[model samples]
Target: MRRPRSPSFQVTPKGERLDSHFISSLSRPFYLLLAITTASLVAGVWRWQASPSMHGAIAFVMIWATLDLLFLLAALGVLYEKPQRRSEPRAWLDEELVLWVEGRPFRARASDGSRLGIGVDIGFSELDAATRQRALDLFHKAAIVTLRFADGKVLQARIENRQWGPRQQHLHLGLAYRFANIQDERYAVDLAFGDSARLQENLDRRHQGKSILGALAHIAVLAVIEGSKNLWWQLRNLWDLAYGAMGRTLRHGKTKELT
Candidate 1:
């Protein structure tokens, strides 16, 4: 007899569903439009074959369907501009952690983490310019960092990169692990990819995207506004050139008459 598979190895339909609900919502309209257009075009061709007198009716249907296909293409172009989140699993932390840089401590929160590295947002609220600069410089120099977890586990890491956001409100650091012990490595792995469901939920929340109609409307409005602006500028430039040429022509005519 064959043995039953473990829960972890079992296949679940829900788990294998489409990546995002918004993608389904956006795609349904395209599929529906394509189906309708194909049916209409096919029917028109069939009717025209049966009765040649129906040529005008078939031509009208063809034109209408072609316009709809153009609209569908425009919708797709707009969808391409929408923001897409990374598919890689990541764990985000709500509480802050303590990071020791060259014996000086700074508070930072774990923004994102993977098996490769951890990204932190270090706050510089109470520190002065020189102190903040010192901290940032230390982090940039690839110095060793000690992170203290809420559970009292200490992990050592080295800075991989650093970035400062808007007005230097906080500093972002990308830290690579320099594990001194086995427990720390295991803890980091567990923190990175241990909870797949939790990470998926976080990803889904970021993908709260617009529906098909909303996306189409947004694209249409922006296109019209931008097109009008370009048209106005082009016409204004043409008018300026025409006016300047006319003045030059009149001046030349008078100069020739005087000569």
Candidate 2:
């Protein structure tokens, strides 16, 4: 006789899940940009004293940098900020499915209930041979189903439909219909969820793979600014506190004599 599966191997029901790492990943770029801007401002200030002619350009950079810093800090705070907990009871589509009407997190299930008689009934009679085979192919692969209601609410659920027997034929059929109606006006499927880490990894790869030309352009601009500072300051004296004070005293003495 086949042995029953251990409790450790058994699938456990999961409650609503939140991706705190995703939230942190979203905010990281802003902090990085802020740090770069701060470094540029410090370098600009040091160059400003020697090259007073670039004061106008430095002031412009400072103003824009300060404004951007404030905006980024505010956005970072808001992104990291947690939403207020809602005490309202959750709406359930079924025992396994929870309706995510609000922006709050909702439970997701691994099983598709269409095979369990809870969803729309679909059979071979409903679909042509080619379509039925295609649907079967889809079932063999892990798929994410996203459903949108008439009221603009959306729900995403992950399922492996291939495990279901003939009794659950409608589950994949319903998924097939939903997939077909994706572009239709009446059926609004917004997004789907699969491997969370894979998605985040793709985003990170795209973010890190900055265009070579774009990077070169940025380097070129910085080079121009630094070059201009170096060229302009070559003809100018370094700002000396004693020299400035002496000049101010001489100007005062000249004014007194004239008076």
Candidate 3:
């Protein structure tokens, strides 16, 4: 296996590092989309006003502009979301680790690691009901576990966090190592993070994104839901006022007849 590179970021000309620029980079495409949408919308409106016969063109442009605008706004929402406090850079890994929990052995894949902690993925369905319960119990007690790698390396760490989340069916286990000395700490760091090239690779992979159709659909749905809410309230208020006026008119007619 190639040695991991050190965790040093290649800074941009704007003096922004990877950690700080990640969010803004995600919004770049959204900004482009919104600009194109706005230009198209203005042209479409101008054409409609000049010809009045291009109703179809204007209608299509309007719908496209709405979806694009909403999607861009949704992207901005994520871009400006509060940042979470994090620890040291974790090197991504996918190697088998033999986890010893209370003398019992369980198989897991080491997913990522830092100097102080490592994350693993375990097959949730592979464990028996009793063992699954025991794993949960260990998490609550901050259980110390001994894990062995395929290369005969071993480490004793405390199970600091456990999350039973969806990943084609796997549970995430986070471990914080209990090092006895500096040597142990150095060994743990080298074993987990290597040189840190994997961490940078992971960051690069995040930038090579997939399709945005799902995001557009999601934002469109939210916009429709919010607009419908306001429409419903306005309609309800109008109905109440109209009903009250009719009732008052009927009472006035009855009083006139009696007089």
Local accuracy of candidate 1 as per-residue lDDT tens digits, 45-129: 7888998987897888788876675565455444432222333345774546899988888877888886656888888878889
Q: lDDT of each prediction vs. the true structure? A: 0.70, 0.46, 0.70
Q: Which of 2 and 3 is the better model by lDDT?
A: 3
Instruction: Indicate whether candidate 1 or candidate 2 has the larger lDDT.
Output: 1
Alpha-carbon shift of residue 208 in model 3 (angstroms): 4.8
Best candidate (score: TM-score): 3
lDDT of 2 at 189: 20
Q: In model 3, what is the error at residue 40, expressed in angstroms?
A: 14
Runs of candidate 3 exceeding 4 Å displacement: 1-55, 80-85, 166-169, 195-259
Question: Please, what are the lDDT tens digits per residue for candidate 3 over residues 133-190?
Answer: 7766664565788888897877888876677776324678788888778877887778
Clashes of 3: 3
State the RMSD for candidate 1: 15.8
Q: What does the lDDT come to for candidate 2? A: 0.46
In candidate 2, stretches whose alpha carbon ends up further than 4 angstroms from where it belongs are 1-23, 88-259
